[model samples]
Target: EPEVTQTPSHQVTQMGQEVILRCVPISNHLYFYWYRQILGQKVEFLVSFYNNEISEKSEIFDDQFSVERPDGSNFTLKIRSTKLEDSAMYFCASSVTSGEAFFGQGTRLTVV
Candidate 1:
C-alpha cells in the first residue's frame, strides 16, 4: 500500500541552525498535514495545506516554520531556527478527509 515516507528518521541539530524535514505523501491524497509530538506528549497539529496554500495552521506554526510542495511527489517542512524545545517527533500525514488519515513513522528532531 502507498503510505507517507520521511527521511533522516533521526536528526540532531544545533540550537540555532536551519533544518528541513522531508516527506513523500501517498500519491492519490489531496490534503496534507504536519504534526509534532513533544517526547511523551500528545500529537499537536502544526499545519494543513491544500491547493498549494495553507488551509489551516495552529498557533504552533509561527513565523519560523514553513511548508511547501516542492514537486509532484514531495512535501517539505523547514524551520528557520531550531531550539532545544523543538526536539520532538515530527509526523507527516495525509487524508482523504478528516476520517481517513495516515501517518509516516516520523522524523525524530533532536536540537541540542
Candidate 2:
C-alpha cells in the first residue's frame, strides 16, 4: 500500500535554529496535514492544506510553523526559531477527506 514518506527520520537542532522537514504524501490523496506528538503524548493537529492553500490551522501552528506544497508530490513543514517545547515526532498525513488520514512513520525532532 502507498504511504506518506518523510526524510531525515531524525533531526537534531539547536534552540532558536530553523529546520525544514520534508514529506511525500500518498499520490492520489488530495488533502494533506501536519501533526505532532510530544514524547508519545496525544497527537496534536498543526495545520492542513488543500488545493495548494492552507485550509485550517490550530493555534499551535503560529508564526513559527509553515506548510508548503512546492510541487505536485512534495509537502513540507518548516519551523523557524525552534524551541525546546517543539521537540516531538512530527507526522505527515494525507487522505481523501480529513476523517481517516494515512500517516507517515514520522520524523523525530530533537532540540539541544
Candidate 3:
C-alpha cells in the first residue's frame, strides 16, 4: 500500500532557528494536511492543502509557519523561527476527499 513518508524522523534545533519538515503523501490522495502533537497534548490540525493552495488553516498557522507542496510528490512545513514551545511531533496526512486520512510516521522536532 502507498503510504506517507517524512524525512529526518527526528530533528533538534535551537530556539530562534528555522526548521523545515518534509513529507511525501500517497500519490493518489487529494487532500494533504499538517498536524502536530505537542508532547502530551492531542493532535491538532495546522493546515490543509488541496489543488496546490491552502484550503484551511488553524490559528496556530500564523505568519511564522508555512506549508508547501513544491512538487506533486513532496510536501513541506517550515517554521521561520523555532521556539521551545514549538517542539512537537509533526504528522503529514492525506485523504481522497475529506474522510479517512492516512498519516506518516511523523517527524519529532525538539527545540533546545
The C-alpha local distance difference test score for the whole of candidate 1 amounts to 0.94
lDDT for each candidate structure: 0.94, 0.95, 0.96
Predicted model with the maximum lDDT: 3
Candidate 3 residue-wise lDDT, 8-78, digit = tens = 89999999999999999999999999999999999999999999999999999999999998978999999
Off by over 4 Å in 2: none
TM-score of each: 0.97, 0.96, 0.98
The digit string of per-residue lDDT tens for model 1 on 1-112 reads 8889999799999999999999999988889999999988999999998989999999999999999999878989999999899999999999877747799999999999
Ranking by lDDT: 3, 2, 1
Lowest-scoring 10 consecutive residues by lDDT in candidate 2?
A: 96-105
User: Candidate 3: which stretches are off by over 4 Å?
Assistant: none
Candidate 2 clashes between residue pairs 3 or more apart in a chain or in different chains: none
